[model samples]
Target: MNARLQPFVLTIAAALLLLGALTYSARAADPEPAEAPRPALTVTVVQPQRMAIPMRIAANGNIAPWQEASVGTEANGLRLAEVRVNVGDSVKRGQVLATFAPETVLAEQAQIKASVAEAEAALAEAAANAQRARDLQTTGALSAQQINQYLTAERTAQARLEAQRAMARAQQLRLGQTRVVAPDNGIISARSATVGAVLPAGQELFRLIRQGRLEWRAEVPATDLGRVKPGQAVEVIGASGSRLAGKVRMVGPTVDVQTRNGLVYVDLASSDEARAGMFARGEIEIGSSQATTLPQSAVNLRDGFHYALRVGPDNKVSQLKLKVGRRLGDRIEVLDGLPADARVVASGGGFLGDGDLVRVVQAANAASAPTPAPAQAAAPAGR
Candidate 1:
């Protein structure tokens, strides 16, 4: 009875061992290959474009009059009368500006007139005497010596009368100098002479600015002087960012030793808001050309080298090395490497590596409006 039970137990043990072996074999089937690592970023990209761009250099400066002058009296006398002009008044050339005391000049003029009259009478007398002396000498009615003496006396009298006439003419000229007249059309900037004030010769009585024309003198650093030139168009922005157009009239030939800068003069006319002596900021169009330009956001600098990711026809990304030109505003010029129609990653470009597989979506195809800069990990430095 014991031997038969032993056989049954052995069969059960074998069945259990076979079931365990089958379960282990099913679990040993090959596992699936590992998936590729995904890119850690999403980005927005734009195509490079060719457009007209104005290259400008910026500076700050002050406004001043182009032609400023101080007009003073030439004659020495008390101010007897002032004309209708005052400070800030516009005056025309040759307009009477002021008058010295007329009484003194009038008295001198009268004396000159009387002297002229006396001299004319003496000339008449001398002429008559000379004629008589000539007749006497020819007819022998008088001694030759006597006639000669009379002629000499008449010549002396004529000389005296001529001297008197010259003195009278000088007096008249001096009287004309008493009235001050404007030398040019200008606006009066100052007035120091009153109606009753006495001014000496060469005393400044007025200051004027001619024709209301003004200039902006911008102090440009010596390093930036190359960007300024005569006849270049410039724009001036005020403290409030108001803009006005002007042309450069002059560029100083020499740099100032103290400030290490040069002056650039921009001529300006009166505008509804522009005023002289106001602080202004100027931007000059130093140079310009048509070029392919892209926003700075589209460029990525790695390892001190510039690069851009170009999108292919199939919306795949490839690395593009670029040569860059001068920076203009928010955009940078693509001097090399990028074709005119190549699309570049505008934002989040730093996240991409060379030859990386990307599932790109059109920047405009996002269901949600393109969000402003979202937080992303820092980009790796390129080699």
Candidate 2:
């Protein structure tokens, strides 16, 4: 190659290299710069307010029949003839629940009646004889020993009549017991007697729950024993989600040694919706308190510590270390690390991080969330 042509080729090569470098630089400058890290979320602050909050204990339990009865018979040699009551039937005192065959009873009763008649006849004959003996003694026709003998015979006959009367009464009682009767007003829960089935004396035939009254038996922790007392109001939740109100009727005298809990009996309010043995949860209002509270959603639990995001006056977000106190309904008390007038992010706090920029919005009323209605709310009647 010629020398001049070589220099010209090198210059051309250099120009091409410089152009390629410039094109790469322009391409890099065309793209947008990476966005800057956003600040923490801003949230409308809430001023912690003083309010009456209920102190309560939640415990699991079961519904129980207030009074349970196992029905039985006291008359032997009787066979079931008819059942007049069935399960779920309401009964009153003296109401006949069942009838038994009265054949043997009637036979015995008839025989006693015959014996009673015979004794009466014999008594009459002896009395007549005693009168005749006395008249003969007055006339000196009968000796004193003979008259005494006749008087003794008359007294024996009268005594025998009296004994027969007592036997008749016993037979009547046995006959009456052949029919099973309700001892008190109640609802029948079970029936075992069947027609033609022979049952011996003291045989259980039915079960009843007296007066349809029910109670919830809650097992509260021994440590919470101080929070429970008789006559305190409570709320009971059934397995079916039925809510019933009641008053504590009794506190057990002893605690269960194994569970370390005590039994609390709560008499159900006037609703008949509750049934025996249903799983139940009860809340007993132990006391009342006044403190700063926040919605449950506002709090976050991380590494066993409770925290909330608070918006500072500068609209910057900061994580607040919080100590929570007793929970009243859907809100928990903020024990510390929060000022009464600070705005804490409630709904969106869980999804935010420190220093993330967030547009702040006012939180709705905390009372709108799930919380116990105050006692003065005037509970609806009939449960």
Candidate 3:
């Protein structure tokens, strides 16, 4: 090989080596890429507000008639001839609800009437004889013993007449009682009288709700008895989900011995949906009060305790256990364990844990957002 060619080959090799060194330097200057930080959840914030919450005593009760009447048979040993009104029939006062076989009663009454008539005839004759005897005694035409005997006979006859008249009146009363009538305006709730059943005196034939009115008998705890009073407003919800507005009519005088509960009687407004013997729940409006409350969705239920997720300024979430009270609509009363000015997650708190970082979005209700507190000046060092 020629020495000149060797020198040219070395120069080309040096240029290639320079290019490789420049490429290595550029690769070393570039920085490594970092991983992207993700948020656990994107949420909104809320602040508690002061609102009016109803103070109520919740109670379980039964729906019953305001007053009940038991219509019974007053005629003894009489067969029910006809039933004019059945269960669910409305009746007025003195309305005939049923009729018994009045034939026997009528016969007795007629016999008593005949006896009364005979007694009246006998009394008239005795009065005439007494008057003659008195006149004769005054004139000395009759002996004293004869006069005394005539007076005794007249007196006995008059007394017998009075007794017969009294028996006749009683029979008439029995005859009228054969027709079972309503004592008051009401709705028949029950009827046990059959068409041909022979009923005795005082046997109940029908049960009636007086005046077609109903009541709610609320069983309240003994502790809350003092809070109940007459004329308080009550909202009762029946088992069929029907609501009835009622006013407290009375409070029971005594509490039950076994349950330590008292009964509160509430007279309900006129409603067709309410009936006797229905189970119901009631909320007595004891009063109202100002309370700090939050939306129910913002609170989470865990292990029978309520919790809320509080958002920090650094976009971190802190779980706060809350003591809650009555829930109205979609809001709930916060009794304790939460600050009135706390900025908490609006919803979805169940998915978060303590110390979880979250990305807070703009609040929907800006007016409810808590204002930022004023910044304080730094204190002088070592003052």
Best by TM-score: 2
Model 2 / residue 298 / CA error / Å: 2.9
Instruction: Report clash pairs, candidate 2.
Output: 39-355, 39-356, 39-357, 40-355, 40-356, 41-356, 45-343, 46-343, 48-340
CA lDDT of every candidate: 0.76, 0.82, 0.85
TM-score winner between 1 and 3, please give it: 3
**TM-score of model 1 relative to the true fold?**
0.66
User: What are the per-residue Cα lDDT tens digits for candidate 1 across 1-383?
Assistant: 69969999999999999999998888777566799677545566687766555666677899888898888877776564765589989899988888887778778779877877887787788778878989877788988888887788788878878888888787777777788888889888788877888777898878888887778888899998887789988878776677777899989899999999899999875764676778998777776568676777778888877889987665568889888875655566788899877767777777777666566557663222222221111111220
Candidate 2 lDDT over residue span 1-383, tens digit each: 99879999999999999999999999998997889765555455455556677767788898988889889999886889999988989999889999998999999999999999999999999999999998888788999999999999999999999999999999999999987999888899888888899888989999999887899999999999877989888888888777898899999899999999999989997576788888998688777777777876788888888888877666667898998776655666777888777777776677788866667666575424444556422111111
Q: Which model is ahead, 2 or 3, in terms of TM-score?
A: 2
TM-score of each: 0.66, 0.78, 0.74
Worst 10 residues of 2 by lDDT: 374-383
Residues 1-383 of candidate 3 have per-residue lDDT tens digits of 89879999999999999999999998899867888677899998888888766667889999988889999998888998999999999999999989888899888888988998998898888888888999888889999998898888889888998999999889888889988999999999998889999878999999999999999999999999899889888888889988888898999999999999999999999988887999998788776778787877899988878899999888888889888886666677788999877888998888888888899887767346332211211111111
- Which residue runs does candidate 3 get wrong by more than 4 Å? 1-45, 301-321, 348-383
- Better by TM-score, candidate 2 or 1: 2
**Candidate 1 stretches greater than 4 Å from native:** 1-46, 141-145, 223-227, 295-383
How does model 2 fare in lDDT? Answer: 0.82
